[model samples]
Target chain A: MVYYISFILIGIGIYGILTQKNLFKFLVSLTIIDTAINIFIISLGYIEGKDVPIYSKYTPVANFVDPLPQALVLTAIVIGVGTLALGASLLVRVYEKYETLEVEEIAVKEARK
Target chain B: MTIATIFVGILMIISAIYAIEAKKMLDSFISLSLLSLLSVFLFVIMKAPDVAITEASVGAGLTTAVLILALRRIGGDEE
Candidate 1:
């Protein structure tokens, strides 16, 4: 069920990336795509009847959930934020110079220059 | 519960669609945050607390800040 939903979200994000004209919308779509991939990774490592991977006094290592995906996702989330900030800053610069957020407009303006 | 997971999944799908399909830049931006929040809930349900915390703080908060700052600079015009 989770995989199905994640695939659907991935498809939606890809569609948005292909069709959206606004620069901000493109960034939003890319974020959505990254999120779907994150969910997919987290779901893949789920084990039935196991507790979270955090160590505890009584918790047996064998009963703990897989921790690798969680660690990867932690880094991925930080990278996602960093990339988002970088993209937004670039968009700000583009908007200042081109005076528009529409992708086609930016391309056309650049083509004419 | 499975029901709650399914519910959050549905919310994620809806939020994703809204974020991409909305007419205005602000609408899409706000919906993107909603999508991120829903994903956080989904992560909690899927037994990934660390990912949920990271997503909640970084995904929902910082991502929105970056987008909004850019939107303000760009004047939030989608056309």
Candidate 2:
């Protein structure tokens, strides 16, 4: 249930991005969708009633949740941030060149030119 | 227990819907921010604080700001 809901949220965001008219809205949707999937992927490693990952002195097999997902999510986040920055810069250039933000309008203007 | 997760789950769904159905780019950005925060909260409830931290910082914070800057530059339809 935990993982499924996260996936559904991600799907919703992706649908929005695909069907949207505004480039800015699509970009925002893409970022949210991206994060949601990362969260979902990380959450998959968690088991109910498990403790943090530590094997130093005490506890047994039931104690630790999988640590790999946490690590992966961290890496995904760094990449997400970099992609968002790059995407935003591209959007800025698109806006400057087109002088309008609506995707349809921009396309029409390009077609005319 | 499952209750907290369920609650966060509902919030996530609502935020996702709002993010999609938003009428304007700014509205979409705000809703997307809300959705990201809800996902972060869900991650925390799932016992993944590391992911929660990054989502809070990158997803909810920096990403939203960047998209908003993009919005300002693009100046969407204004309708």
Q: By TM-score, who's the top model here? A: 1
Retained true contacts (fraction), each candidate? 0.91, 0.74
Per-candidate Cα lDDT values, in order, are: 0.87, 0.77
RMSD of each: 1.5, 2.5
Candidate 1 TM-score on chain B: 0.90
- lDDT per residue for candidate 2 within B1-79, as digits (tens), equals 6887788788878877777777766777787778778777777777777777887887778877877776776654366
Q: What tens digits encode model 1's per-residue C-alpha lDDT throughout A41-97? A: 999988878888887776755577789999998998999898889999998898789
Once all C-alphas are superposed, what RMSD does model 1 give against the true structure? Answer: 1.5
| Model 1 alpha-carbon miss at residue B51, Å | 1.0
**What DockQ score does model 2 reach against the true complex?**
0.67
Candidate 1 residue spans exceeding 4 A from truth: A57-61, B76-79
Q: Model 2 compared with the native: what TM-score?
A: 0.87
Model 2, residue A56: distance off in Å is 8.4
